[model samples]
Target: MSLNRRCSRTACGRPAVSTLTYVYADQTAVLGPLATFAEPHAYDLCEVHSERLSAPRGWDVLRLAPDPNAIGPTTDDLLALADAVREAARPVPVTVSAPSAETGREVARKGHLRMLTSE
Candidate 1:
């Protein structure tokens, strides 16, 4: 393996984005991201490195992505995860009933929520 844990695949340098945690019954393997070389970047282990990843106690792991070089949980990582959650939670389009007598008042009172749930 390369000293930097870079992707073993030639002509590609994308860093591993996430670890492929494999669980087979009781065995598991944690594959680490190998590398990615550009923006919107995610590095992942090459097939070779991925195959080599061995989980102690026979756990099977597949692969991870982004930068495997990234070590330790930091505040930034937590914030990033939170941002991802927020992005995923973004509302999709929903059908709304026409304003009823009370509905107009409800909408007026819940304008903020309406905006939040808007498509």
Candidate 2:
């Protein structure tokens, strides 16, 4: 089910960005972005995956556990998960102007991708 508060992980103060829903007796745990705008579906995430959900890298850690006993959203309970997801996924509209030609050209000159080395 969707949690109202942030992740229980103390070091990760980031909000609970996903759900770890396990269906009763099921061997899978459904993991979904807490920000999904649609109805929550059955998508299981393993222990490692759930931990990464709120990670700072903006990476989705949703994954299926290898063993069925791990955790999985049961077909029995239908929590008010969609509502929470919609709330988290609410989009904030913003506008950005096109980059100037100079900026684009400079980036091209530096190559498509650049890696910074410590000074």
The estimated TM-scores of all candidates read 0.24, 0.26
Once model 1 is optimally superposed onto the true structure by TM-score, how far is the C-alpha of residue 31 displaced, in angstroms?
A: 20
Off by over 4 Å in 1: 1-33, 36-70, 93-119
Error of 2 at 93 (Å): 46
Please state the error at residue 76 of candidate 2 in Å: 24
Top candidate by lDDT: 1
Model 2 misses residue 25 by how many Å? 1.6
Candidate 2 at residue 12, lDDT? 51
Tens digits of lDDT, candidate 2, 1-119 = 33444554445555454556544444444565543332344333333447655432433333443443524454442355666778889875443333444424222213244333332
TM-score of model 1 vs. true structure: 0.24
* Clash statistics: count for each candidate: 33, 13
Model 1 error, position 50 (Å): 17
On TM-score, the leading prediction is 2
Q: How many backbone clashes can be found in candidate 2?
A: 13
Candidate 1, residues 57-89, lDDT tens digits: the string is 544555445454556557897999899999999
Candidate 2 structure, TM-score to reference: 0.26
